[model samples]
Target chain A: MEFVVFIIAGLLAIIGALGLIGFKNPVHSALSLVLSLFAVAVLFLNQDAQFLAAVQVIVYAGAIVVLFLFVIMLLGVDQAEDLSVEPIAGQRPIALAIGAGVLALSVLFISVAADGGATGQQSVTAEKVDSITGTAQSATAALGDNQTDGTETIPNIEQLGRTLFTDYVFAFEVTALLLTIAVVGAVMLARKPKGELAPLPVIPGRSGTTDETEELEDA
Target chain B: MELTSTWYLVLAAILFALGATGLLVRRNPLIMFMCVELMLNAVNLTFVTFGNDLNDLGGEISVFFVLVVAAAEVVIGLAIIVAIMRRRNEATADDLSALRG
Candidate 1:
């Protein structure tokens, strides 16, 4: 059952990525990206990174992609891009060659890893044993019965939160600062230039209705 | 055969390659931005896979930071793109060759 699910999710992810590249319309590509992101989130769930999966869906698919679409619509740049123009000479051929090389190298490295040693499950089990032993001693010393066992391991979210707040506190706080600066910068960049004159109140003298004139003025 | 971390890592690498290709192939700035997001997602997958493989929370925590950074990047990047598009009526990256000497 798990294998079947993995296969399905992986297929969806790859298909979505292909669609992202294949589609001519930017809106279609954005939608395809959402599909890819959601599929990856499912894979994350399968890997037991529930928190990361939820964050991936909420922040990435929900917020960031939505922002992309909003910009697309606002700019009215949704028209299909002209494919014939190679504005940058010889870019596509080079990109394709490099992309192929990267894929080959990555696959080769993975195959050569650890002499085709233990499967993922074996490595995970071994790591779990090591962690349990290592944490049992320290965690037991600090928190007594809060110690974790193999079967009763702390949930991924809880572990993530504990680590973020304690071990990675500085990095987490820096992320908050970064987000604040980004928000400020985005607002500054997206806002209309301050010196631009506000549209005059619709003096209904000339052509179309008050609404049309207001629209014209705004434009 | 059972699925393993290697499988996920390989899948991520493929996705990353596709993203890089798309970034280079697509001339539209918006599409290139989407490709960048794709690459970031691939990296996120790798981090989670390693976190699971190592039985440690460090990878996951790093993923959180990456997410934050990605979000920040998206906002700033899109804002820049929109500003450029508004001035020029299109967002093709190749057309923005003002810096070309």
Candidate 2:
């Protein structure tokens, strides 16, 4: 059942992504991107990362894509000319060959790696616990308690928050600073210019050309 | 019928490839930006899949960071686009060759 849910979510995400790439209109593409982001958030929720999933929905689907739409609307670029540049005739074959070669090499690597013995599935679960808790102490406590009760225990959001504020505070502050810089930069870039670069050109028949026009008419 | 999570990863990879191709081929800046977003979401899907597959929370946390960064990128990217559109009426990526300055 969980696997089925994952499959559905993945399929929806892929379909939305396809739409995002295939759509010619910017607004439609942004909407499809939203759908894809939402699907990924659902997958995050299924992974037991409730807080992350909520943040995903809020940040990606709610805020970011809406910003894109707003800019698209504001710019009023509805009549965009199609400007897809096809690869030069000779370059296409070379590019295709390189891509194929890379794919083949990756396939060969994966096949060889898959044949190796699965030495560390259990270790992965252990490592997952440590990384999720963001500390050895909490993970140990969680595991110790779980082992005593013979039940699986997942760390909740509060523990995650504690770690974020305590150990990861510097990183969090850095992210905040980066966001502030981005916002300020965006605002500055989007600000209207105070002056024109050049004076408007005087039209031949307009803009105080009436005397000349009358003389020409009389002649 | 049990489908493996690897199948989802494969699908995500295909979507990512499509988005990358669009980004490379499309000369419209807006479409390129949209394709970039598509690629990011594809990566997010892959992260979520691995999170579930490994029963790991870190992957999801990473996804959160990815979302935040992607949002920031879109905001700044759109601002840049608006600036470019204002300076030059054209939004085609090819016209941006003025960046050679």
Retained native contacts per candidate, as fractions?
A: 0.66, 0.42
Maximum-DockQ candidate: 1
Worst 10 residues of 1 chain B by lDDT: B92-101
Which runs in model 2 stand beyond 4 Å of their true positions?
A80-155, A196-219, B1-5, B51-56
Local error of candidate 1 at B39, Å?
A: 0.7
Q: Which ranges of candidate 1 are over 4 A from the true structure?
A: A114-116, A119-154, A196-219
The Cα error of candidate 1 at residue B8, in Å, is: 0.5
lDDT by residue for model 1 (A1-219), tens: 767877899889998888888788999999999999999999899888888899999999999999999998998878887677777789889999998898899889877873455645556655666666554223223444443553455466665666566656787788889999999999888776544443323223223344544555686
- Estimate, for each residue in A14-59, the C-alpha lDDT of model 2 and write its tens digit: 7887677667677887888888888877776776667777877887
Q: Which candidate is the best by TM-score?
A: 1
DockQ (CA atoms), all models:
0.47, 0.42
Model 1 quality (TM-score): 0.84
Model 2 residue A116 distance off true place after TM-score fit, in angstroms: 4.5
TM-score of 2: 0.76
Q: Candidate 1: which pairs clash? A: none
